[model samples]
Target: MSRAKRKIEHIHHALEHDRDYYNHFDDIDIVHQSLAKLNFDELSLSVEAGELKLSSPLFINAMTGGGGERTEQINGEIALAASETGIGMAVGSQMSALKDPAERNSYEIVRKNNPDGIIFANVGSEASVSQANEAIEMIEADGLQIHVNTLQELIMPEGDRNFKTRMENIQRIVEGVSQPVIVKEVGFGMSKESVECLWNLGVRYVDIGGRGGTNFSKVENLRREKPFSSFENWGIPTPISVLEAKSIHKDLHIIASGGIRHGVDGVKAMVLGGEAFGMAGTLLRVLLQDGRQALISEVEHILHEVKMALMLMNARSTKELHRQPYVLSGKTREWQEQRM
Candidate 1:
């Protein structure tokens, strides 16, 4: 199939399957403050990711582009939602757009709608400096996300098996681009070693698109000529991945993505040290299944929930949520104990 057609299929599959595959394993907790001494209206939600300042701590993450009319419509709707809500957004892998310059318009529609919003252009980690630059230029992105997905490639029939030069390639991109480079996991999650490597390479931002979310392996498994059981469940869990990344580079900005749902989950992510959160599957479902108004309502609902969570925690702002005392338990606690 052509890259563009594949792009739309991927988005549809992600929206349909993410809830079943990703949301089953984890839960987020919020510590309520009975003496919060503040009203919900007093809560502050503004936070910054790199040079981009956001009205809320959430962003519609990288999903799809470079397909045909349907793909353009999907991107346009997502962009419209982001623009209407005043949130940041990341377009899906621009490799297809890079391959066919004509497909660039599909991705560009995001910025065309969200003129004042923070737009993040994306490409695979395998992309060269020139390709990365062109992607940023095409979207006029405020930042760039280079997604690493060795697992997805392994399961993909057309996957790139040889990723030996990814580190060097990422380093070059970080050095070559003026924009802040966000090192993101395309669902396999980031290990401490990988986080250190990216930090050393000057990646000040990282997105732990951890395991407990979309199983790219499962996504690819469906397309396999012959089914493979080994690729079904792979990679680190969300909370554990965050702990690992924070241990190595405490100062690096981290955005938690995979499997995150609702306001309390967003609160737990911040308490666990994630500066921002990205929601794709849940938001995309509302967009694809219910249309743009539904997606906007869902986002607004989450924002209100997040603000209420902050008020309950007595957090005056996003930064305070990071420092608010909390503890991890269950599988997450056990994972951290073993890792630490």
Candidate 2:
């Protein structure tokens, strides 16, 4: 299958089957503050990712590219939202455009719409350093994201299975690229050991694409000709990944993803040491179901909720939220205890 066809299939599969993988691990909770003196208007949300200074510590996350006209439309809307809100955005894997130059417009639409906003180009870890460089140039990205998805690749019918040379590719890309290289997981969260490895390799930003949001494994299973139940529920949970990755590398930039829903969840992620947050499944649902205006309303609602949480915590900014103490309990606590 071609990249464009695969892109469409992936998006449709994600919309249909991603929700089943959302494990309702309710034991993770953020204690509410009732006696707070801060107001919502005083909350600050600016943060730096690589060379770009995001108005808010939030990104739309990588969604899709190379699909065709529909992919262009979706990316255009997302870019408009990012530009309007002053937040950064990431484009999905650009391998399609790299392989077939005709698909370039699907990814370029993002830059066309949000010409000044920080946009990151995404590619898989298996991609060669040359391919990675091409992907960045293809999108004229502010930064580059290399996604690691061992589980998804194993389940994906057309996915690459060789993982032994990934580090070599990462090292080459890190050394070869002029822009900052961000190593991210697809849905399976990055372990502390893995985080340390990337840090050692001079990679700065780490996106814990934890399993609570869109389960790429599950999504792949749904798309597979013969689904495998054994690999369906594989990966680190979102809260646990954030906690573990932070414990290993406190100074590194960690973007919390996977199952991030409302403002309170975003607050919990920040308190747990995430520098920023990624919202994909929720935003995609709104975009596909109700179009651009509905998606805009959803983004505004989440931002308001985030501001409210910050105010309650007396956190005047995203940086302040990181300093405030919060306890992890239930499943997240158990996972941390065992891993730590």
Candidate 3:
């Protein structure tokens, strides 16, 4: 199948797949403070991920583009919601556009719709320095995300087999690109060792795209003639990935994603050291099912929920959430103890 055809299939499978599977965020609980005094009106939802600043900590994560007109419409609607809510948005991989100029408009619609919003251009880890620059310039993106998805590629029917130069490619892009470079996972989470490697290669922003949200393994397996069911439950959970990334470096900015469902989950991620929260499957489901206005309302509602969570924790801002107390239990605690 062609890349564009595969893009639509991925979207369909992602929306149809059951995301109710345990993501381990439930294993975390932020201790509420009653004696502490803080006003909700004074709380700030602003966050800084590397050099890119976002009005709200929650942003529309990479979802779709470069499939065709359908994807262009999808990206346009998502861009509109991101613009209306004043949050950052990342387009799906621009490799298809780079390979075929006709697909360029599908990704370009994102920048056209949200001219002033913080936009991020995404590419696979295998992307070259030139491809990365073209992706960033195509969207006029504030930053660029070089996503690492070994598991997804293995499961993908037509995915790349050779992965030897991914790290080298990422290093070249980081050194070659002027925009902020974010090395992210494609839902299968990152380990402390992986985070350290990226940091050593001059990468400061890491999106621990943890498990429990959109299982690209499952998505790709659905497209395969013989599915690899065992790998579907693979990879670290989002909360655990955040802990792992934080355990590596104090200065490494972490964006907690994969399986992030709501505002409460976002707050839990923040308390665990996620500089920003990214929601892709959930936001895409909202947009495809309920339409653009509904998606915008859902984004607003999530922002509201984040504030409410902060207020309940007696935290004045996103930064203060880190100072607040939190408890980890179950598999998440076990992972934290074993890993950290």
Candidate 4:
């Protein structure tokens, strides 16, 4: 099948399926302070990564692209939300656009809609440095996100078999691109070991696309003749992965994703060391089910909740939000206890 058709199929499956099992955000808590001296209106957040800054940390991460006009329209609506909110936006894998010039408009719609917002161009790890650069230029991206999905690819009949040179490939892209290169897991989470590997490769930004939000293993299983249900519940939860990334290195800017269902979850991620939180599945569902206004409403609702959490934590800024106290419990605690 063509990339556009395949992209549409993936979106359909994600939209219709019940892929969530354990989010693990419930395993961590951003302890509240009743004596919070800060007011909600005073809470100003700018996620800092070294010298890089996001005026607003809330963002819509890429989940679909290059699936023809339908995908393009979906992207346009999401980009409209991002542009309206002043948060960053990421376009899904531009590989289809790279292979077929006809599909270029599908990805380019994001740039056309959100002309001034911080936009991220996303690609698979298999892409070469030149290919990565092209993906960036296609959308005039602010940064490039290189997604690693070994299991997702393995399950798909048309997916890649070679992950051997991914590290070297990432290093090349980070060196070749003028924009910052961010390595992200595709709903499989990132461990301290993985973060260390990327850090050693000179990649400073990592998005822990943890399990529990969208399970590609389960999604792909539905596409197969006989599903591999055993692998469905794989990978570390989002909160645990954030904890693991926090333990690895303080300088490694972390972007927490996967199963971040609401703004409260976003707040929990920050306390666990996420510089910013990404919501793909929830945002996509809202847009598809209720249209553009509903999507904007959802984003505003989450941002409001984040402000409330900040007020409760007495955090005056995103930097101070991370300094507030939090604790891990339940299975997430067990997971960390074994590793720590």
The per-residue C-alpha lDDT of model 3 at residue 333 equals 93
Candidate 4 segments exceeding 4 Å error: none
Q: How many times do residue backbones clash in model 1?
A: 0
- Model 2: colliding residue pairs: 213-258, 213-259
CA lDDT of every candidate = 0.83, 0.83, 0.90, 0.87
Write one digit per residue (lDDT tens) for candidate 4, span 73-112.
9999999998888788888888888889898998899999
Better of 2 and 4 by TM-score: 4
Q: Against the true structure, what is each candidate's TM-score?
A: 0.96, 0.95, 0.98, 0.98
What's the ranking of the predictions by lDDT, best on top? 3, 4, 1, 2
Off by over 4 Å in 1: 18-28
Worst 10 residues of 2 by lDDT: 18-27
Residues 1-340 of candidate 3 have per-residue lDDT tens digits of 7889989999999998877456698898788777758777889999865687889889899999989999999999999999998999999999999999999999999999999999999999988899999999999999999989898888887888999988899999999999999988988899999999999999999999998988898898888889999988889888999998998888899999988889999989999999899999999998999999999999999999999988787788898888888888999999878878
Q: After best superposition, candidate 2 residue 144: deviation in angstroms?
A: 0.6
Q: Over all chains combined, what TM-score does candidate 4 have? A: 0.98
lDDT of 2 by residue, 133-183 (tens): 888887789899999888888888888888899998898898999988888
Task: Supply candidate 1's per-residue lDDT for 237.
Answer: 75
Best by lDDT: 3
